[model samples]
Target chain A: EDQVTQSPEALRLQEGESSSLNCSYTVSGLRGLFWYRQDPGKGPEFLFTLYSAGEEKEKERLKATLTKKESFLHITAPKPEDSATYLCAVQAPKDSNYQLIWGAGTKLIIKP
Target chain B: SAVISQKPSRDICQRGTSLTIQCQVDSQVTMMFWYRQQPGQSLTLIATANQGSEATYESGFVIDKFPISRPNLTFSTLTVSNMSPEDSSIYLCSVKVQLSTDTQYFGPGTRLTVL
Candidate 1:
């Protein structure tokens, strides 16, 4: 079965701290990996999509990179406003159906 | 990016009752999906709402439990039948405008609590 796993279920970072969140996935045929930021009591907001190994995307102070086995979300000098849950999801090729395999998500708290 | 909206932002319900959540998108989208999320847990795809067709449910979900209706390209409804304590969750609706980008825009979500 295809699955997506995110590491460090919870993290606490002081303002300006830089860190990286990990999302490891095992799929029959990888199509795309997505990153999202979800604030409390709200739906997820789109972040980045990595299609292949070595692909990278950036937004503001955040960057996402993908490899064959895993994807990483790197936060640079995060602010208190950056505190939120980061979600990772993977999509398999057409053969695996159109469902997206989602990770448990990483809850990051940045305190000032 | 598409803007999605869901009715009944949050609700408290009694067990055995049912609730129908509505999802609307600002623009006509090609794909619409429904998901359930327990507190502090990951999202589980319930089904894909296809316009003018029956929804495609996931492995653990059934059409009888999560009946979905897509009357048009920009509107859909998901009815949770025979609710229980286990059914208490945050339901979200998402839209995909373009398949090539693989980007999904989500609505505010409906938080349901069954007692």
Candidate 2:
């Protein structure tokens, strides 16, 4: 079965500290990989989409890179406001309904 | 990106009662989806709400247990029937805008608490 797994279920960092979250997926005919940021009691906000290996996207202090087996979301000098659960999802071309296999998400906390 | 909204931002219901969550999008989206998130867990796809057609439910989800209706391109409703404590979860709706077909934007979500 196709699956997506994220590493470091929870992480804590002081303000300005940098870190990276990992999302490893095992699926055939990978179509796209997406990143999202979600705050408490709210729905997820779209961040970036990576379609091919070596592709990278950036927004503010966050950058996402994709590879064949995994994707990494790197946070550079994160602030407390950047604290939230980062989610990863992948889409397979075979599924006609455009279903997304989601990861468990990594809860990152940046404390000042 | 599309702006999506859900009615009943949060609600507390009794066991055995049912609740219907509504999802609305600002644009005429091509696809709408429903998802569930249990406490401390990841999101699970419930079904795909196709306009003017029966919803396509995911594995382990049944139409009778969680019925979905899409009356138009921009509106949909998901009803949780015969609710139980196990049904207590955050129900979310997402849309894939026609302009951005590859990405999905989510609504604020409906938080349901069953007791």
Among these predicted structures, which one has the highest DockQ? 2
TM-score of each: 0.97, 0.97
lDDT of 1 by residue, B1-115 (tens): 9888899999999998999999999988878999999999989989888787789887899988999999999999999999999999999999889867778889999999999
Model 2 docking tier (incorrect/acceptable/medium/high): high
What TM-score does the predicted chain A of each candidate obtain versus native chain A? Answer: 0.96, 0.96
Docking class of 1: high
Candidate 1: clashing pairs of residues: none
lDDT of 2 by residue, B1-115 (tens): 8889999999999988889999999888768999999998899999988787889898999999999989899999999999999999999999988645589899999999999
Model 1 Cα RMSD, Å? 1.2
Off by over 4 Å in 1: A94-96
- Report the error of model 2 at residue B36, Å: 0.2
Which ten residues in a row are the worst by lDDT in model 1 chain B?
B95-104
